[model samples]
Target: MKSLLLAVCLILALHCGEAAVTCETVAEDLYPCISYVAQGGSVPDTCCTGIRTLNSQAQTTEDRQSICRCIKSAMGGAPLDSINNALSLPAKCGVNLPFNPSPSTNCDSIN
Candidate 1:
């Protein structure tokens, strides 16, 4: 019984440790990039920095999907230009993403 309990605790700890960032956290960091992406203005250093931080922090597939969901949710109320610009943001920020953040993208298949 004690071994089973220990195993369960270890599994939970591993799962918890794998998630380096949450959707809320990603939202907070990436929200600043919305204006730059919506407009055609220069991507500010702050925005790029946030993008880089997001890329580095989201290490697992779950993290990536969470970010995707947050981005999709946030973009749902945005203009077309903003959505289009979001697709271009990874390249613009020099961050390579496994899947393009688009309306049609299946975040589950990101890995």
Candidate 2:
């Protein structure tokens, strides 16, 4: 019983740690680009250049959402509803976004 409890505790701890890491990684990787894009700036060649590399690392919705949050946060009070509205565009326009494209891109394109 004690061993089982220890194992469960370890798993929970690891999962929590992983969640935090995922959020931080997404923010660090995507926030700067999102900020630039939000200002009516073009995605730098470097941004597109790194997309394939970053896509390979994003594997889940939480990871994607973290990046989205980072982008919205960078936008300085951009509403979540507006951001989400923006994110729906690429698919609507047949542009296949990277695994976790900034919601701002979709928002900018459509709204």
Candidate 3:
């Protein structure tokens, strides 16, 4: 049992590391913006920083699609009543996103 658990952990870690950009990574990178995205308020510099970083990091089409899926999933699960504010984050941060991040967005169609 212990060996199986360890193997599972190793496999998960390897999978995450292999992507270098995963759903967890997307969630983490955009975590700082949650408050602003959920509630209408001044977006923190850190949020913009994270957005910019996310933009730069997601260089490939695959990465962008994955990120879009991750973001959509996160937003879908968010407690916020409205995600309209979140939609403006990329533009506010001066970052252009290939796909819109919304609960209704089809992640598979991002590419």
State which candidate has the highest TM-score: 1
What do the candidate models score in CA lDDT, each in turn?
0.66, 0.42, 0.68
Least accurate 10 contiguous residues by lDDT in model 3: 4-13
Note each model's CA RMSD in angstroms: 12.3, 13.6, 7.9
How do the candidates rank by lDDT, highest first? 3, 1, 2
lDDT of 2 by residue, 1-111 (tens): 344334323432333223333434544443334433344334454444344344555455554444444444443344554345335434433446544345344422321
What pairs collide in candidate 2?
86-106, 86-107
Q: For residues 1-111, could you state the per-residue lDDT of candidate 1 as single tens digits?
A: 344334323433333323567655765566567567657678877878888888887778888876676566555555688678777788888999766778777877876
- Tens-place lDDT per residue, model 3, 1-111, is 344334323433333433457766766677677668656688899989888888888877778777776666545544555367788888888888777878788767866
- TM per candidate comes to 0.75, 0.39, 0.74
> Where in model 3 is the C-alpha error above 4 Å?
1-18, 77-81
lDDT, candidate 3, residue 83?
65
User: What is the Å distance of residue 57 in model 1 from its true position?
Assistant: 1.2
Winner by lDDT: 3
Screening candidate 3 with a backbone cut-off below 3 angstroms (N, C-alpha, C), the clashing residue pairs are none
